[model samples]
Every structure is written in structure tokens, then in C-alpha cells.
Target: MMKRLKSRLSSIVIAICLPVIVVADPIVGVWKTEPDRKSLISHIKITACGDKFCGRILSAYDASGKEVQTPNIGKKLFWDVVGEGGGKYGGGEFWVPLINVDAVPQMTLQGDKLLVKGCEHAICAHQTWSRL
Candidate 1:
């Protein structure tokens, strides 16, 4: 019957479009990084870059929560990050501005908090950032 054929076609269309409709990753947003040693915090914006993800510094604030000028603004902090589902992401390069080094980074997202860990050679560090 034509009705049965149409119903089958509708089901196929919905199945094909469902994944595209829900493809927005939860990690795509602005996140507030933990204060550095100097007590300066930065806001990083994460967005899709190609098939991966990247984050860049959007703004910086002093310990008093006052916006400050920084030379690192608009710099890419992380790139080539791939989401591995289940709130896990890895396969990215993280830049350490303090030491001017690049490291492998792994990130985990839990609710409004993101834990970023990076290691270069024998040195390793981790920081927790919050969603802003």
C-alpha cells in the first residue's frame, strides 16, 4: 500500500537525520580556567575545528576579578582535540605559556567542571576549569 511505503520512507528519513540533529558537543562553550600562579584567570572559548576541537583565550582577569590586558589573549591554548564520548577527550596538544612548551593533553568533563591534564616528558600538571 502507498501508506505503508510512505511510513517506511519517513522512518528512514528520521533515522538518517537524528544523529545530525544531536551532533552538538557539550564541550563547545566558554570555560573559566583556574587562576595561574599570579592569580590571573582566563576565559577560554572552545569550538569545533575541522573534525576536532580547539580552545583559545578570550579574556583575562586579575585576582580582583577586574579585566586586564594580556599578550596571550586570542592565543590557541589547545588544538586537535578529539572527543572520545562518555565525557572524555584527548589526542590534543596543550600549550604551556609559563614554560613555553607543548604537551599532550587529556580532558574530562563532569557537569560544569572540566579537568585538564597535560604531560611533557617527565613533567606533568593538571588543572580544573569551570563552565562560564
Candidate 2:
């Protein structure tokens, strides 16, 4: 009887702890793409649409910190962010129309940095993102 009671308690504990082991949506935040020292691409809002993730262009500014109106607003910067388990995400694509570029990136959340790498089999551009 004591062994059965202990087994039941262990089961209950495991059930309660399973969800704790899972992580929340870490990519749902703001991340800026560094274009250069004088300017950067501002992804004002990063959010999940169903199972996929996307980045929205809040605004774009040029050198010397000025908001320059561009044709990229309300565009989907990233898409198809899939969970690869262990708080890592991959198999996603980002579309930046201003530059006419579309690439696949592997995403990982480390502390406040949402590291996104655009890898096209031969080349890659790393974009480090901080939560706004």
C-alpha cells in the first residue's frame, strides 16, 4: 500500500512538472535587424500567427536617427518558425522587400537576444535581436 501511494505521488509530481519543462513563446517580441552602424531594421513587433511566427515592420529609419518612410511597413519579415525542441527554432523564412531578399534562418532565443541566421547552403548573415 505504501509503495502504491508513493507511485501515485510520483506520477502526480511528474504531471505537474512536465509543463514547467516546456518553454513559453520566446520569439514573441521586438527585434531589430542591424543593417549597419548608422542604421538598423526595426522589427517593432514579433508575434505568432497560429503555429507560425512573423515579424512586422513598425518603422524604418536612416542614419542619424530619423524615421524614413519606406514601402516595407506591414510586411512579413519572417515566417514559418517551427519548433525544433529544446527552445530552438528553425526552418523559417524572412522577406525583406526593400532589398528584394528572401532567406531561410535558424532562430534561437538566448537571454534577450533572438539570434537569426540567414543560411542559403553557402552563405549566411547573422542578425542579433533584442527585445523591445
Candidate 3:
């Protein structure tokens, strides 16, 4: 009887902890950014950088869908992004190299699309990016 009870307890423990071990944050993947002013798009890879969520530009392309060969490739576009769970992420800043613009961003995820809103004091901008 004791051996059977121990087996049942172990089974219950595994059942409770298995999901926590196997589950991953939904936003941890590559995402395609919306087109910029010059109609160029960027591929941003979202990953856990240090203790926070960060996205880096893996590549860039122009309106023709051709690779633009810019220095922005492999650049960290946003950092210090904290995922507060429940499809919400914030506490990050957007860094644009070309226009030299930076703003704090708040993000929400819906299905495979990420909606991000950036605000710098009174000015604000929004973009929706798709998962790649």
C-alpha cells in the first residue's frame, strides 16, 4: 500500500509540473515589422535577452521585397521589454537608427500579430507586426 501511495503522489507531482516545464512564452519567436517611411520592412527576432525580452533586427528589405543591405541588420531595435503575461508586454524603448528616434513602447499580442504603441511625451506611433 505504501509503494502504491508513493507512485500516485509522484504521478500527481509530475502532472502538476509538466505544463510549467513544457510551456514557453508565446512571443518568443521571429516577427516581421511593419514598413517604415521608405517602405522598407525589417525582420525582428524576439528572444529572452538577459532577464528581459528583447528584439533584434535580423534583416531588412525594401518595397520590392529585396534585401536592402543596410547597416541596421543585426541591430537591437528594442530592449528592456518585460512581458507581464496575459498577452501584454511593456517597459521597453524603440530605437530607430535612421531617423534617430526613440520612444517607450507598449505591446499587445493577438494571435500571430503584435500591436505596439510607442509614445514620447506627447507624440505617439503605432504599428502592427506579424509573426514570421
On lDDT, the candidate that comes out on top is 1
True-structure RMSD, every candidate = 4.8, 5.9, 5.6
lDDT of 1 by residue, 15-90 (tens): 7775443347888899999998779999999987766889999999999999998889999999999888899999
* lDDT (C-alpha) at residue 96 in model 1: 84
Better of 2 and 3 by lDDT: 3
Q: What is the C-alpha lDDT profile of model 2 across 74-130, one tens digit per residue?
A: 777777777687658877787645456877868888878877777665866776877
- Extract clashing residue pairs from model 2: none
Q: How close is candidate 1 to the true structure, as a TM-score?
A: 0.82
Count of clashes, each model: 0, 0, 0
Residue 73 in model 3: shift from native, Å?
Answer: 0.9
Best candidate, TM-score: 1
The CA lDDT of each predicted structure is 0.90, 0.71, 0.84
**Ten-residue segment with the worst summed lDDT in candidate 2?**
18-27
CA shift at 42, candidate 1, in angstroms? 0.4
The lDDT, on a scale of 0 to 1, for candidate 1 is: 0.90
